[model samples]
Every structure is written in structure tokens, then in C-alpha cells.
Target: MKVTQRAKWRYQQVRQARRQIRYKFKPFKHTRVTRRALAAMVQRVVDQSQRYTLRAHKTRQDEYKIVINGWPDAVQVTVGVHSLSFLVMQHADFCDFLLWPDCMPRRKHGQWRCFDTGCLASGPYHRLEDLLFNHLAEPFLEFLTKVPEQAQLMLYDMEGMHHACVEAVKPLKRLDRPEHPVVCWPLPAGSDIV
Candidate 1:
């Protein structure tokens, strides 16, 4: 018996279909971090701090707002199993401050796009904990304490602040700095932030 070209092509198609079905039903190995767990982590960090009075309140099913008393604005954080998003809201405008697991491409105007499942990294919980303490909380506290006035100014001038922040971060990307410490904001002529 001779196998014709048509038979070979049909065999390949069937094999491909089976592979697709297997992938569609494959059990996900990595467990997802719950919103409540993420919120509790934030609370622990806030409790340890002494500088600012920060309170984490659950505003939605998957979102929490960190309210800082005596501050001009509130920080909104959304947590996912694989990603975290930080935003600051002032009046009616908002700023996308940072995105964790920094693998996703940034959108135009310096905003970060959502995480892609294909870019998921191992030990997401550990990475997120580090980011929460070092990247999100530490820099945020510094921004409030070191330059309280500047932080307020940024909230007022959202567009200019965003542009400055985008420009400030461009050099860091090229330099590949491990820690992001700068909070770029508008300043008077001949004045600089050190």
C-alpha cells in the first residue's frame, strides 16, 4: 500500500488539531495570588512605615486605594496574580506611576501596558513583594518627604510632570539601573533636584 500526498497532508492536520486541543485543556501550574492577599501585603508594608499615614481601602473587586492623609492625592493600586499597577489621582486627572514585572512594552505617553501571559516570570509573588517595598513604597515615601512640595506640584501639572518623568526615565532604561530613584517633576529655572 502506497500513502499518497493527500493522505500525508490529512495526517499532519489531524496531529495539529490534537495538539491544539491538548493545549486548550492543559492545567495551569502556577497558582494565582488573590486580591485579598495582595491587599494584606500592602497593609503590612504600610503598618511598618512611620513617615506617612497611609491607609489601604478596597474600592473594587480587584482594586485598592491607598489614601494618605494631608496629601494632595491618593494612590490607586490594582493587583493581579502576575502583575501590579500603580496610579496617582489628583482632582480629575491621574498618572500611571509604575508597572511591575517590567517586561511589558510601555504605551505611548509613558503609560505601561498590561502584562502578557507569555511574559510571565517565575516566582511572581517574590518579585511583587520586592517591588512593593523598594520600588513602590520607598520611592513613593521619598517623593513625599524629600520633595513634598514637588510631589504636590506634579499632581497639579499632570501633563508636564508625566513628560518630565518619561524623559527622566529614558536615560535609566539605557543605563539599565537596578533601582529607580528619581521622581521627575517641574521646577523653577536654575533649580535642580539632587
Candidate 2:
């Protein structure tokens, strides 16, 4: 069998077209959480938490910033007319995570937004606290627990931040160990000698 150059070109073109069509029709794997949805999650966490206090203050003409203050850290959520920005602060450690909305067309230098699909999706989270606790608090705590090793090779790092990491991990030290059941069983009299 002989294949012409024109036939080979047509075959490649058909394959390229099929690839494009498949790419265009592919389903999105995850859903994005909008500003309002994130705000509601933060509000719910604040409400359910006994140790945290919520405060609201007007930031702009129509924008309001909600601040959640408590033990591990504090979260500042800026609710604007069309966008939302979140800033989670570990006051003692001076470490913070600022997350801007993904909907924004442009972002300033050094700005970051959430990139985790599971964290942004509402379907996986039955209660808002689960979303907030797992995504928000857990990440910061994990970072705090690793600061010392992460900064060990650095020539210079913030002393206070290291101090804060110690303070944060002190209470959580017990969690690093596995608990063993304490049980005592009396050996039978006829059992073999040890």
C-alpha cells in the first residue's frame, strides 16, 4: 500500500481537530468558592468557636472587614462590593497568609490566592467549620510546627518568629505521640515461666 503526502497531512489534521474538541469539552474537576461563600464559612467558624471573637469594621464606602480573633491566630476578611480578600495572621509569630479572590482580573506583586480546589469547593465540606478548620487553621499550624527546620540553614531569620513557633507547638506536643492502652492481665498459675 502507498500513502500520498496529501493523505498524511489530512490524517494529522483530523487528529489535531479531535484533540481540540476533547480539550474544549472536558469537565471542570472542581468548583470555585466565591467571595460570599468564603465569607459565610469564616462567619460560621467564628460563631461556633468559643475561644474566638468576631469584629466588623467599615473599610471603604461600601466594604466591611470582618476580623476573627482567637488562640492559634487571627483572620481578617475584607468584604468588598465585588471581591474578597482574606488575611490570616499569627500575631505572636508574625507570620501571615493573605489570600485574594481568584476572580480578580489582576493581582499586585507578592499577592497570593487560594489554589487548592478542595479548599475552595463547598461540596466536600459538610459543615463550614470543617472547611475553615482543615484549610485555614491546619495549614498555619503545620507551617508553625516546621519553622525551625525550615529556617535552620538560613543565615538570618526572625528570632521572634521562632519564639512564636515554640509557643504554638508547646500545647500540641502531646498530639505527636501515639497513645497506648494501659492494661494489666493476670497470668495463669500454670503458664510457662518467663
- Whole-model lDDT for model 2 versus the true structure? 0.39
| lDDT tens per residue, model 1, 84-168 | 4556544343354633332222222332232445543322333344434443445454554444233422332433444122122
Task: Report the lDDT tens digits of candidate 2 across residue range 53-160.
Answer: 456565654456766442222445665423455554444444333445422111223222333453344234444334444555444334323433212211112333
Best by lDDT: 1
Ten residues in a row with the worst lDDT in model 2? 180-189
Query: Which segments of candidate 2 are over 4 A away from where they belong?
Result: 1-33, 56-66, 69-134, 137-194
lDDT of each: 0.44, 0.39
What lDDT score is found at residue 161 in candidate 1? 48
